[model samples]
Target chain A: MRNIFIIFKRELKSYFNNPLAYVLIIIFSLLSMGLTFVIGDFLKMNDASLTSFFFFHPWIYMIFGPAIGMRLWSEEHRMGTTELLLTMPISAWQAIVGKFLAACVVLAAALLSTISIVFTVYYLGKPDGQMIVSGYIGSFLVGASSIAITCAISAFTRNQISCLLVAVAVCFVLVLAGFPRVTEFLRPNFPALADIGNSVSFWWHQSEMARGIIRLQSPVYLLSLIGFSLYLTGVIIRGKRS
Target chain B: MIDIANLTKHFGPKVAVDNLSLSVQKGQVLGFLGPNGAGKSTAMRMITGYLPPTSGSIVIGGIDMLEDPNAAKALIGYLPESAPLYQDMTVEGFLSFAAELRGLDGQRRRDAVGNALATCFLEGVRRQSIDTLSKGYRHRTCLAQAIIHDPEVLILDEPTDGLDPNQKDVVRNLIRHMGKTKAIIFSTHILEEVEACCTRAVIIDRGKVVADGTPDHLKRHAARAGSVTVRFQNAPGGLRQDLEKLKYGARLEAVETAGSTLSAVVYPKTKADASNLSAEIYELARSRNLALSELHEEPGRLDEMFRELTSQNKV
Candidate 1:
């Protein structure tokens, strides 16, 4: 446990030390806030909930999560530091947890920077605080899931670009899984998938959070996905050691 | 103590390590000598628990490596070929992280980190980021992290691979000082390195042991049946035949002369004595007005022995 925290702290500090973290935060804030108001002020989807804030999660995560998680292990392998870390007294699971937690810290920080969007909507009208809080929570959970899955995938290759591409492709599939027109196309051939449709989708769960509904099943799905992906990362890392 | 028995590693069809068996006692420095791709690094990695052996048992300090890998690993300090470091971190930050990973804290951690920094001569770069440091400083930082916990065993795979002469001397002295308490296993192709640092050496070739002993033992082995060539200032017409018939040599391979210089290789008999051989050659040449340009015994070459051992396996 102590070893895990030691690795975690070092990994988190490494993020802050890198300029990419700051760059990503600034760019993500601009993109999230910029896209929300451009559509809100133009389309006038005036509502009490954070429909605009939570609507952009699926698209935002497609690029943001992969960029943050691509170098989790691929860079380590390229630098030849994997041998040193594996030879230490820590277990495979400890390394996975440390890296996953470090990515989460960055994910949380990036999520926090978007809080300005909440104030922008709150001053415009009396938006429900509960719904906004739920949306943020949901957005954070969805980002957690994306980063976790991408981090596991990053361990499969030593090239950071390959990791990023694969992660974006995977997240893209999960995003398209929830669209209404996509489900309508699925309803004729695959009724089960259509029934599970967008409901089992990331956007579906995130919508529930955005509308101030903190359902237990939503977190269960996200947590389990993150947990299983992290388990896979541990196995992949242990395979690389030999 | 470190014990490895019947260790073998296979990468697909290529056998990296084949039935390697060795042991290192406390306070003993074993120099693992081999040519490139001779399984030195593979064996070191397995011993350090970085790679698992296909069929073998490794026990470090009474802890079974396969069962309690963490405990066994905690007893060792390993430095791979390239010192893997977080370049964004400063020397002190990196050392502190290493100390924390090894479960050290408070004053003892500080003292250990400080001692290791001072021991490796890294105090000057303590506050500098590793990226801005020189290659020598980066390597020293890697070494400092390895020994921060003062493990019972140190496995260094070419620890001095990239250092200059002056830095090599410093690291060599540090390793020698540390060897007084810990068992050190260092793999290197530098023959003089074994002479300066190792108490004993094991030469592995083609994934097998070819020679194992002290430097002096190897030297003496090479010294047997030594040959010497004689050059004369003036011509000694029958000196070659007379010396050959003196009975020190089983056969004389050749006798050549160019401008009154003579040279021959006398293949000494198994029971021939060096003193008799020298005296007989000297007498044969003196009576013929030969000045004896050169007539001295050859010093042993451990480097040649190493080359011969590895080449034999290569063939």
Candidate 2:
């Protein structure tokens, strides 16, 4: 546990030590708020809720997740620091979890920066506080899931650009899996395929939580996805050592 | 403090480190020498537990690496070939991280980092970020990271590589000084480094132990070892013929006569003492009334022995 914390502290500090983390947070904040009010039609909706803000999270995280997590393992391999890190007394799992959590914290900071939108809704009128909390939770889970997938992809390659590109493509597929149009198209010819796609889709689970439903399966699905991807990351790293 | 037996590693079908075995006791500096692609780095990686061996056992301080790697690794300080470091981190921050990973904390961690910086001569750049530092400082920072915890076993892969002559001398002296209590294994193709620092040297070729002995012992394996050279101002008629017929358990390998000055090198027929052979030649020269300028025995060369041991043709 102490080893994990030590690694986590270093990984997190590394992110902030450069301009990347600050730039990423600023961009994510601006994009999410801009999309919510402009493309999302938040003011036009005339509703006392953050529905428009929550709706754009999955899309914003598609880029933010990979950008934040892409360098986690890829940079280590590129700099040849994996030999120094893996040779330490800590287990591979500890290092993986440490880095994963560090990225998650960065994602959380980006998500929390959008709390101004919640204050706007509260000032305009009374909104369902529970539902708003659930919406933020759902957005974080979506971001965490994307970051986890990016971590696994980063472990597979030593190039940060390739890691970012490949992770974006994978997250694109996951978001599109249950996209309303794609699901509608598949529902006519392959109804069962549509159900299966929705079952594994990040969009579907996150949308459920954003609706204030908070089903047990929603958090479970996203958590399990993060768990499985982190497990795969450990496997790839250990394979490299041998 | 390190006992490795039959260590092997196979990258797919290609054998990177074959069935190699070596051990180092406390207070011994073992210089690992080999030509390029001789598996020196691969062997060091396995010994440090950075790469798992295909089939072998590594016992560090009596702790089995395979069965309990964390405990075994805790006792080892490894500097990889490239001396990798987090380029964005300050020298102090990096050393603190390494100390923390080694289980040091609070005052102990601070003290360890400080001691490492002082020991590696990195106190001048403690607050400087790694990427901004020069190559020599970067290498020393990585080295400081290894010794922060003051591990019992130090495994350095080409620690002095890419350094200037002055830097190399400083590092070599540091290794010799630290070898008093720690078991150190350092790899280098530079033969003189082995002579300068190693108490014992092991030469590997094609993933196998080709030669292993003290520096002097390995030098004796050179072809020219136990040979004598004689330089005379005045040449004697039939000097080569007389020297060949004298038969003092030696053979006249070559003789050069240059404008009244004659020089000859005599090789011992067997592994006899070069002094004994030279004494016999001295007697013959004195009897022949020859004016000899210089006469001495060659101590042999490490480069010759290295070439002979690691040559591809040698089985």
Alpha carbon lDDT of each predicted model? 0.84, 0.91
State residue B291's C-alpha deviation in candidate 2, in Å. 3.6
DockQ of each: 0.69, 0.89
| lDDT tens digits, residue span B166-283, model 1 | 9998888887888889999999888888889888889998778888898767754563335555666776567667767876765665678887677876655642355567666788
The 10 consecutive residues of candidate 1 chain B with the worst lDDT sum are: B219-228
Worst 10 residues of 1 chain A by lDDT: A40-49
**Which candidate number maximizes DockQ?**
2
Supply fnat for every model shown: 0.74, 0.92
Model 1, first chain, TM-score of 0.94
**On a 0 to 1 DockQ scale, where is model 1?**
0.69
**lDDT top scorer:** 2
**Clashing residue pairs in candidate 2, if any?**
none
**In candidate 2, how many Å is residue A201 off?**
1.0
